[model samples]
Target: MAGKDRQITLRFLAEPADVNFGGKVHGGAVMKWIDLAAYACAAGWSGKYSITVYAGGIRFVEPIHVGNLVEVGAKVIYTGRTSMHIGIDVRAGDPKNAERHLTTHCIVIMVAVDDEGQPTQVPEWVPVTEADIKLRDSALRLMEMRKKIGAEMAAHVTPGG
Candidate 1:
């Protein structure tokens, strides 16, 4: 699919209800937004209902204030037989002005699913631009790191303890 067709952006205002005790938007709220954006991008690219299988490297770089204009952008960076790696960026700024700063970033792995909830194949995503190529490479590196981290954790942790 073309790059433009494999991306989605959601923009909205951060509300007071989204604020945490620290006077900024709650981390959970931000994460929910990220998941929603990633789902939209993955489903759009795959043309099937997509479910988040994994989300990692979620960095809360800066606080998002109430009333700030929040933007969540998600793009398909890589594709496997059934999964799509979505890169998500969250930015926020004063709604009155045009400036926005990156507030969070993460990588989400979404798998397309059939009506029965079984994993379904998705259309392959090809990198066409320099940015796309770089993002795809980054996703590949993250996948490798995830494997190593998972192995290390499994070795040290017990199922019930």
Candidate 2:
């Protein structure tokens, strides 16, 4: 699949404050970067102000450490009438060892809004590459997975008598 039109990259240096006692980077910090990067990508795609309505399926595969350089990549993956799905990938690098790592992945949903702060439909996106296809498929898969999980949870939640 081809990449999105406006891919954005954000890089930051991990500090002691950004990591946990175990030397692993804090999940909260990663989450914050994810949201920020996703916001930028979504806004770039929509060309309008947007607000995050949902952030789902943030999975951390590896722990990052202080002194590592964290790189965040953001892209617009899907679009609805007024909402867009943004995908973020986090990687880390240890300059001393010349090693790079993948730490986390996440997706966030944001909606475009009008000047009055009401939800507004976005213009049609022009997807021109295979990466866009991959992004679209990934978003659809996550959405379906969330829906199935929600249905199962609802089925198991017995109403109080």
Candidate 3:
């Protein structure tokens, strides 16, 4: 499982059902795949069910056409006492040629949960490989940006009487 592995790659074909009116894969459909991939990655590392607390920085770089080979790469970039920040990149291309282009990318935060559905602690992630270290550093930068954004939102949110 991911809890022990910490990274996973999901590959499949883009079906026609995932296409939009413009004949390209729908954005919502792609997001669903991203969420599922992230969930799998988090659950693997946490050794328990996990819930997505946040999904951000989704960038759709190119349109995914029906019949293209799709690959969703997910990795646990950072972990907290009870949370894991997963980074995902979606790429699609010709399966026969084996060349893939980045179609979308995003970051998702998943929180491990116990049987009672409450948050639980996840094993810490220590970077070993150079790629892992680079991703961890990027995750740290994003975390800081998230904190700043949260603070700004909290200051503007009106309290209920």
What are the per-model C-alpha RMSD values against the true structure?
A: 1.7, 3.9, 1.8
- Give the RMSD in angstroms, all C-alphas superposed, for model 3: 1.8
Q: Point to the candidate with the largest TM-score.
A: 1
My TM-score estimates for the predictions, one after another, are 0.95, 0.82, 0.92
The sequence of per-residue lDDT tens digits that candidate 3 reaches over residues 1-161 is 44588888999999989999999999999999999999999999999999999999999999999999999999899998999999999999988888999999999999999999999999999999998899989999999999999999898878993
For candidate 2, what's the RMSD? Answer: 3.9
What digit string (tens of lDDT, one per residue) describes model 2 on residues 1-161?
Answer: 11234668988788888877677888998999988888788777778888998887788999888888888998777888898888888999885665667889888888989899999887555566897887788788888998889888898888993
lDDT of 1 by residue, 16-81 (tens): 999999999999999999999999999889888999999999999999999999999998999999
Clashes of each: 0, 6, 4
In angstroms, give how far residue 37 of model 1 lies from its true place: 0.4
Clashing pairs for model 3 are: 2-44, 2-45, 3-44, 3-45
By lDDT, the better pick of 1 and 2 is 1
Clash count in backbone of candidate 1: 0
Error of 2 at 131 (Å): 3.6
In candidate 2, stretches whose alpha carbon ends up further than 4 angstroms from where it belongs are 1-5, 96-99, 152-161
